[model samples]
Target: MNLYTFGKALVKTALTPLYRFEVTGTEKFPDQGGILLCANHIHALDPPVVGMTSPRTVHFMAKEELFKVPVLGRILPQVNAFPVKRGMSDREALRSALKLLKNGEVVGLFPEGTRSTDGVLKKGLSGAGFFALRGNADVMPCAIIGPYKPFRKVKVVYGEPVLMEPYRERKASVEEVTAVIMASIQKLLDENSEK
Candidate 1:
């Protein structure tokens, strides 16, 4: 198995016993083809849980700083995580994500751009909307429910794919598209819980 698969297996092995990680709405996920897994970020663990539970390998956009860390930098690439500058428009990161989508790969994005310390769903960045509009990929709204604590049940809910046809082949602003994606995510958060 590749590093991502092997590592994901390890995560599941370790986490399943420590925390009851539950995944639902996976049947709603597309079996193949390019797709975006846009989720609300609450913890550092968000990315791995989302990636590991996903039906496909997810090429995630992580912060540029993490790549500078000694061992993590080496491992990030092997697991399909590219880095992005946090504050400014990181063209390099955008290009990497687009290329991956063009090749029919899954890309995970946290529209909020950073972890929400209080676990509240915050307004998402327009970058995620840009990806949905620019790439020929289905945008799937995802939510990570529950706090990341040992022995706690954390759930990853994959909601229905947000339809982007109206915005496709047209001139829709990124913010407008992002609102729709965020709304979808909100609905999932409304319906499910960690309990």
Candidate 2:
């Protein structure tokens, strides 16, 4: 395996026991092939928490500003994450995501586009829906509940995959497709919230 894959595995393995980790509906994740893992953003720690618990390597997009720093830039790429400009439609980021999916790599995305200060599902951006249609990948809804601080227990839930066919038709608007993607994540969150 490449350094990125190895590093991700190492971090995930080490962190798994640190949190009171409980994963529900993980079987819903595809056993193989490219998959778009759509997740609801709750905290900054949500990425690694979900990434480590996932059964496969998940390539995600990080903010470009984070890459401007010397150390983070180097490490982010090593973990299979690329930088995307904030407040803009970054075609390059989108293309990179699509390329990863096309190559059969699992891509993790926060449809909210950013973390929510309050632990609630937010409106999703169209970028995820756009990539799903372009790459012909299945959108797997993920819900991560609870906090990361104080080294307490947390919960991450993966929901059933939502295929891209119904929205692939040209008649469907991007906003409509994005809404559907968010709804899937929201449903998972609602189901797993108490835990």
Candidate 3:
């Protein structure tokens, strides 16, 4: 495995016993090239959970303040995570994401823009749809179930990739497209969760 993939595996191994990590439908993930992974964020650990569980290297957009933490700041960039300014669409952040995509690197985006306090899927921003359209990349809708906590069985369910062409040509507004994407994510959550 590549260094990034190895590092992710190590993280997964370390975290698994702490929190019961059970991921299914990982086979649905694309085996190669770039992909835009859109997921519902419910906790601060969501990004790392997805990053470590995914079959390929997944990059995350973190808040700028996170980079100030001595340990996390050093480790994040090493593991393909970069900083973004929260509460604003930082153009530089978007550009950095786009650059990764253009180079066939996968990027993980939380459509809710931040973690959901109630652990329920919320209305998503249009950034995901916009990225898929602008990047000409497929969006892999993912659903993360359970609280990411010690001894909890947290599941990361990845769905088949959703192509952008149909959505882009549908004449629907960006908000409409985002709604559709969020709905798909909710469906995955409803079906995959331990009921």
Highest-scoring model, lDDT: 1
Q: List, residue by residue over 171-191, the lDDT tens digit for candidate 1.
A: 789999999899999899988
Candidate 1 segments exceeding 4 Å error: none
Against the unseen true structure, what C-alpha lDDT does each candidate score? 0.89, 0.83, 0.83
As for candidate 3, its clashing pairs are none
Q: How would the candidate models be sorted by lDDT, starting from the highest?
A: 1, 3, 2
- lDDT, model 2, position 62: 87
Task: Give the C-alpha miss distance for residue 32 in model 1, angstroms.
Answer: 1.6
Q: 1-195 in candidate 3: lDDT tens per residue?
A: 655777777877888889987888889887776689999988877887888888888888888998999887887788888899988879999899888876888999999987789988888988876777667677889999987778978888998788777876775576777777898899899998777
Q: What are the TM-scores, per candidate, against the unseen true structure?
A: 0.96, 0.90, 0.91
Question: Once model 2 is optimally superposed onto the true structure by TM-score, how far is the C-alpha of residue 89 displaced, in angstroms?
Answer: 2.0
Which residue pairs of candidate 2 clash?
none
Q: How far is candidate 2 from the true structure (C-alpha RMSD, Å)?
A: 1.9
Question: Could you give me the TM-score of model 3 versus the true structure?
Answer: 0.91
lDDT of 1 at 134: 87
- Displacement of residue 51 (Cα, Å) in model 3 is 1.0
Model 2 residue runs over 4 Å out of place are none
Best by TM-score: 1
